[model samples]
Target: MAHAARGADAVENDAEGLRRRVAALLEAHWDEARGYSVPNPSIYPHLWLWDSCFHAIVWAALDDPRALRELEATLDGQLASGLVPHMRYGDAGPDTWLGPLERTSSLTQPPMYGHAARVLADRGSRPADELLTRAVRGLDWLWERRRTELGLVYVVHPWEAGNDHAPRWDDWGAPGRTRADYDRAARTAWNKARMHDVTFAADGSAEWSSSFVACPAGFNAYVAFNLAELAELLDDAVLAGRAAALAEAIDEHLWDEEEQLWADLAVVGGGASARSPTSEGVMPALVTTDRARALAALRQLDDPDRFGAPFGPANVTRTHPAYDPDMYWRGPAWPPLSYLFWVAFARLGLHDAAAGLRARTIRAAWRSGFAEYWNPEDGRGLGAVPQTWAGLVLAMGA
Candidate 1:
């Protein structure tokens, strides 16, 4: 028993070291001269809210006020309707997918302002009104935009959806991935099938890497939680009424009676004919409502056949054939998704569930060394171990 305890201690120490190193990588990779708005860590050397929020988590430790500033810096990029694009382009760097759009357009992530806002909420220095007001603006944007048919938020692109391949996609055609460039079709193909199409094995040595694609689960769940909070925070009775109505609509519409999992949307139309049970989809229960149906959706987690994992929740249920343990977003225990689940459970008063998941996530992070994603069963680090968001979750215990 003593030896086992020592082993556990050693593992914890190794995990802590990895977390520290990941944080250092984030700071070092940050293009400070570019005003901190670009060159984010998670999605590559570009400014992305997904990375920025996690970046805020670490910066919170170094300087709480600066952490809040980090979020504020990203806010400046909001589009006309307050739509925050998933990413903003920095000065020329490596040629990457979504590279062209990043240079030309201004887009944002799903409204995850609440996560960042709550972080600011922890800092008494920022005026509550200021923090709440900015957060409310972002929430208002989500209310105005991003909703799909049947009231659930509709993310136009995969990046916004976060959990790319929920079970629903199996019925529709699998999402086709693009080749990286003329030089690396095989590597890109390998990435499309095995990795998240973001990275791949340069020479087949199990060296996990990523490219510039986004995940659907990360963004969908973000809006689910943000909108739920907006329903509570909107000051105007009319706006509050609208927010509540939208929230309820989401619950009713998204609560899939058949699968018992929330799908991205019913993809009947030719353009949107790809439905999936993205990790982000489960977020309605995780963040918005605590109804029995929502809870049932989470029960999918225990479906040893579907999502149950020794480390943390897999991005997709195992019942799906696409379920590849090493596939980046397809089947892995990711920190950000788990962190969102952890907090969502807490918000819904499921403290025990939240704590249990938190503990599991911490262990997974330690075991996987804070990788971008880990094997759900073996806890081996998969893509970009020491990815920014994984480290952020560990540091904040989110």
Candidate 2:
């Protein structure tokens, strides 16, 4: 018993140390003169909206005002069309950040602007109406760009949609694209699991190995959440009306009743192939969705042999043949995935379930010491150690 106690104590100490290191790393990487910038390891000044927002929450816990500043940097990148370009070119070259032209795909990820805005509100960090308006405009942009005649936002880039590991990619790659076509100079140094086409660049930025397109789950869920919040804040019934319609459409398209989960569409036959379903699916319960059928669809959340592992939620459903615990993006126990599940449970009033998942997530992240991703069955770390987003997720302890 004494030995067991000692072992437990050792693990606790290790977790505490990791938390501290994460805090320090965040502080060091913060570039105040440049508006509290946080770069993806290999590239600098190419701002990412979701990543910065994830870090901002931790910053809010530490210094509320700086957290607000971090968000400003993200908002700065929003285009006139309400499109928040995935990256903000600061000093990096074309080779960095996936060709650096704000992507050609008309559809981009639903910027979870409302969530970030709400976070700021929690801290009493108010900027200006202009900022909020710009965010809203970005949402409007989505309604225009992504919404099809069917009203569902079509995701053009997997990364833009925010479900980076969506099962759809395991089959059909980006719409009519291949890894060899990517500019090698833009590969991010921080991401270890990449298939970069080039080793070097003129601007010292490395490129990526693989390119992906159009996954819809997280992007729509986020937009739905944003629209809901906007409806409340602005009394814009039109916004809410459109958002509701989009939600219904997304449910109809993405929810595979047979699989009982949310997944992105996959393309077949290279660039010329038609879109199909991929096995890399995640539970819709990961995000807040109010469609009546959503709950029934998520019943598979705790199926022991499939997704319910000793850790927490796995990005890919365990039943899928492609479920590999060691793969970088496919079946990894990612903090972002767990983060969404934590929120979804809380929102649904599944307090007990939420608390349990939160604990597992915290345990996994702390144990992994903020690795970029982890093995689904064990808390062993993999990929980038002390990753910024992982640390932020850890600090968000449920």
Candidate 3:
């Protein structure tokens, strides 16, 4: 009994420490602009779309009112069409690379804003009506401008998918170049063309000649999840119907029965008809309604030669020829992705797996001081330190 009490006390102390760390990290990155939370203080000083979503989740978990402000700040950058840019630079800092004309990029990140806003409102950190209204407008914008006839929305740039350098984008010509060069060349060119069409054309017909457009399975899953959440909040049958239809479309088009996983499909030239199997592809299984299929897909997370690694799940299958534990998204285990996997596992009743992953993730972040990602093989922290989503470790306590 004494030993058990000591163990419980240790756990309590650890939780307290994590709470303090989350507060410090978030406050350190809080931009002067009301709710904007930078991913990192020194490295990423601008507000990012999905990063802010994760920040909101962390803040809401801590009962911080700043969570609502973070969501509102991101929405402030939303375009007239309701399309939110991937990142917004306020006042053009010294490190601003895109020049002084535009404060934000034309492209957007994964559709996690609605889901994040719902999370905050559910926690009583924000009003549901206000956030849901903003979410619906953003969803409408995406449906109008990005959704394909096939039902799944398409990403014109790999960065928009938030899995930059993933094996799925290998054929789209993303690897082997510095991230700076890749952004300046492929991303900049695509954004410029998109901006031109959206600015000059009345119908907003932006034709992407580049072969990088793709319907990523993970991205569509996020869209469907967000739409369903918004539909529930608004009690709108039409939005609910759209969400169901989109979910069905994803299962039909992206699911691979033979491989027992989901994969991306190219919507433009230059991309492979069949994307290489990666952890990002299997992420959609989290929202899958098919029990047997979801179970089968979850098995991939346990395969030693696939996502299963010594420390956590790798971003790409270990057996894949392109797997690189040291590379950014090719194989490194990211805290945000790991947190998503934990949520899915817990929802699927895989409590033991989820608990184990939560422990590993929290331990890794603690050891690395909130680095952007970690080596799945040795658990060595890499990339930006004090990353925004690294604070997701605190959510385990909630």
Candidate 4:
């Protein structure tokens, strides 16, 4: 009994230490001048869309005053057209292939700010009218300009998908147009091959010809999840109906029955689905009312042949030949993704699974010195170290 008690005490102490370190890391990344946390100092120094969303969520969870403040930064480049650029603040956020703009990226990322803002509201950090309005505008802009005829959201660029190097793009790859293009060279090629003619609409959303198009399970899932949350918070029935329609579309188009995984749909020449398992495929559970499908997708995480990993589910499943433990998106364990997945599982009533994922994610980030992403096979930090994404660990406690 005494030995067991000592072990438990040691575990508690370790958790407390991790919490302190994560807090300090988030503080260090905080840009008081900008009133938002920079994702990382070395590689990613500019403000980003989803990164800011996660930062705001972490701050809200800590009950810190910075929650709403950080969230405000997410709207830094909101145009009159209601589109918010994926990255802003400076040139570092812009890319050579696009966004010849002065300060913002030409594209948008997953509209995670909606979910972040709703989380803050629930925590009594409800944003003021301006914040809420911009949030709604951003969503409206995407719904109007970006939604496919199928009612599912489509990403014009692979980068917009936020899982840049994911194998879901392999079918439209540079070479085979269907090869396993892993390290992002194909994606870069696609970017460079663009017409280099980007025109901004009256609303300020960038418009380009011959763009890449795909409907990702994760991106659409987040759309549904965020829309559903915002509708409930604001008592908007139209948004609720839109959310339900989108969720139904995701179930109809993205779910792959044979594979028992949610596959990303590439919409370039036609509709092509990814065959390999990916962590993003499991995200629909957050809004999926199809219990049987949600449960099937959830089971993949427990299958060692697929997403199962020591840290969390691999970005790409372990069984795939493309799974590279140390690579960026191909197989690393990303903290922000872990948080999203944890919420999805919890929403699906898998409390124990969510708890395990939350604990593993916190420990993994702590052991990795708050990396941007890390090798899931080991606790080794990879990508940008001392990243604020690790700050998400505080949110797991919430």
Candidate 5:
């Protein structure tokens, strides 16, 4: 909070110190045998899709070769059909919900490796040529297989949106929102009831669960962003066109002008999306074609009544009935998400706002000791301590 009042030189110096601390924490979370940074050595103990992507970006910013190794490690357990699983257990042991034989998750998370690869190359690191090809395979697979009729990448689970605790999926529970009302037990039950809907093959591909097949604005924005960047890096016209079309589709179908935020489109049509204003709702600014729409969505970050926390953007509106500054995914200021907003803001020429977020995020990461997420209201650490993704503030402030 003081960052806004502090002199620019002082803020930059403070950020450099925070960067050093984050770099050390990232190193501590690195799993040598696994070749990737675990989210939290104690709590998570496994690699995740978007987390590793954020780690790679921070690693590259630090000039660490681990950045390349992290990306390579991410390809492990990838399906033959090019679906990049959201989680890879390796020797850490499969999660109980994943079943004994299953290692990688059947579902995919937000696709950000393409954007990570671009960040790596931008840093002058020649990630193997095959890496780009591999990343595109996953994107292509989503477009061909998981795409809803809306032309947006359809995600089967809320985890794919990476905002697991957000209220968008509250319809799953009736008196309790399908037990999704901050109840992990109920959420798990809700999951098992329909887990059999999708049948997996030997190749790790599954018939996607159609009941929850919805296009989340945040998820598709990352896909569209990755495609657009990869297209430029690879010089592919077809991919470029697809990226443009995807972005345009997000505008045409998902933009909720009244909310000034992108709303997740539920195909089945029951809840109408709860209309909960989430930080991820602004993610479409990364790829949306309309400058006015992008600016308006991004300015939500500057509004105190909405996302304007002293730390990075709040996970939800402060006015929301369920806003929780310390709850995971409820309203914490996550470094990776803040980093995304910073990038999006800068891309649209909102440099001042982006800089404020950069300072605030780095400060929060510092004060929270690189926790998994921080209290949006007070910058107190919550969730896993010394998590690697918080290190992403290095790249954000840089």
Candidate 6:
């Protein structure tokens, strides 16, 4: 009894320490402008879509009022067409490429606002109706402006995918190309698309003029899951149906039967490109209702040579030629992604796996003081120190 009591006391102390650290980090990054939360105070001063969503989620876990403000501030940056920019910079920042035009980038990150809003609403941080309205608008925007004929939404830029510099974009525009070359081609395609007046049509079709587009499995899964959550919040049958259909489309189009995993497909010249697999590809399994398929996908997480590295689930698989432990998204283990997979594992009844991952993540954060990511091989923290999502460890523990 004495030993068990001591262990329990240690756990409580650790939890308190995590909560204190997260609260301090959140306070540090809270922008005065409508209480928007930045991903990092220095490295990423701008309000990032997914980062804000994550910030709100962790805040909601603590029942903080800043949670509501974070979502509302992000909503204020939404465009008239319902497309929320991936990054919204404050007026004081150094001039960026988009400074000549709108301060917000035309591109967008994963549609996670709906998911974040739903989480906040569930925690009673905001009114369900208000959050539902905002979420539906964002969903409608994606369905109208980003959806392809194949029934999946496509991202026009690598940054918009939130897995910038990932191996998946290595051959974005042309095979055997460098990152700089791909960026130039993507930029040129984006400009042409904008010049041609690409916009969402009244008939639910996108008047796209860009050749650079990709339907990433992980991104589409996130959209589908969030749409389902929004549908439940709003009790909207149409959105629910669309969400189901989208999930089906992802399975049909992105799942590789032989590999037993989900992969990304680039829409090039109105046709599907070859399949590209990354650690993000496993995300679809999180939302999959098909037991067999979900189990198969989860199996990849247990493969030591693949995602089950000592400190991973690396961002890219170990077997991939482009695997580099120090590279940002190419192979490093991010806390956000690890937390997400932990949730998925728990939901899928892989409780032991989930608990193990949670232990690893907590230890890594404790060792590194919330670094952006960790080296999957050595468990060494990398990237921005004291990252916002790295503080997500607090919520994960809760």
lDDT of each: 0.55, 0.57, 0.73, 0.77, 0.78, 0.72
TM-score winner between candidates 2 and 3: 3
Worst 10 residues of 3 by lDDT: 198-207
TM-score of each: 0.75, 0.77, 0.87, 0.90, 0.92, 0.86
Flag the better candidate by TM-score, 4 or 5.
Answer: 5
Candidate 5 off by > 4 Å: 1-12, 99-101, 174-183
lDDT of 3 by residue, 254-339 (tens): 98776778889887744662477777766776677887877777777778877888667888889877777877877888987888
Best by TM-score: 5
Q: Write the per-residue lDDT of candidate 6 for residues 1-398, one digit (tens) a residue.
A: 23322343345347777687788888887887658877777778788888888888888887798888888777767776777767777766433343123556666788778778777777876544665577688888888767888899887655666786677766543322343443445645544444344343443223343555678888888888788878877788998988898889998888888668888887743233235457788888767778788878777776877777766578777887777777777688898788778767877888888878777777666655578897887667677877888877776646
Q: Write the per-residue lDDT of candidate 2 for residues 125-146, one digit (tens) a residue.
A: 7546887788788788777755
Q: What CA root-mean-square deviation does each model show from the true structure?
A: 8.2, 6.8, 5.0, 4.3, 3.4, 5.5
Cα-based lDDT at residue 7, candidate 1 = 47
Per-residue lDDT value at 17 in model 2: 65
Model 3 stretches with alpha carbons more than 4 Å out = 1-13, 93-101, 177-209
Range of the 10 consecutive residues with the lowest summed lDDT in candidate 5: 1-10
Q: Give the TM-score of candidate 2.
A: 0.77
Q: Tens digits of per-residue lDDT for model 4 on 61-149?
A: 77788989988989868887888888886535434555655677778888898899889999999999888889888888878887888
Q: Write the per-residue lDDT of candidate 1 for residues 1-398, one digit (tens) a residue.
A: 23322343355545455456556756665555654533325546666766676666666655535566667756656554555556666655434343223342333455666656555555443425665566667666655554555554444334445444434443333442221221244434432443233221222111112222222333545665565554454434654565466556656555556667654443332223234454555776644454776677666665677787878788777777557667666677878778777766666677777666766666676667567788888777776645667655555352
Least accurate stretch of 10 residues (summed lDDT) in model 6? 1-10
> Can you rank all candidates by TM-score, best first?
5, 4, 3, 6, 2, 1
- The residue ranges of model 6 lying beyond 4 angstroms of the native Cα positions read 1-13, 92-101, 173-209, 269-274
Give the C-alpha miss distance for residue 128 in model 3, angstroms.
5.5
The Cα error of candidate 6 at residue 31, in Å, is: 1.6
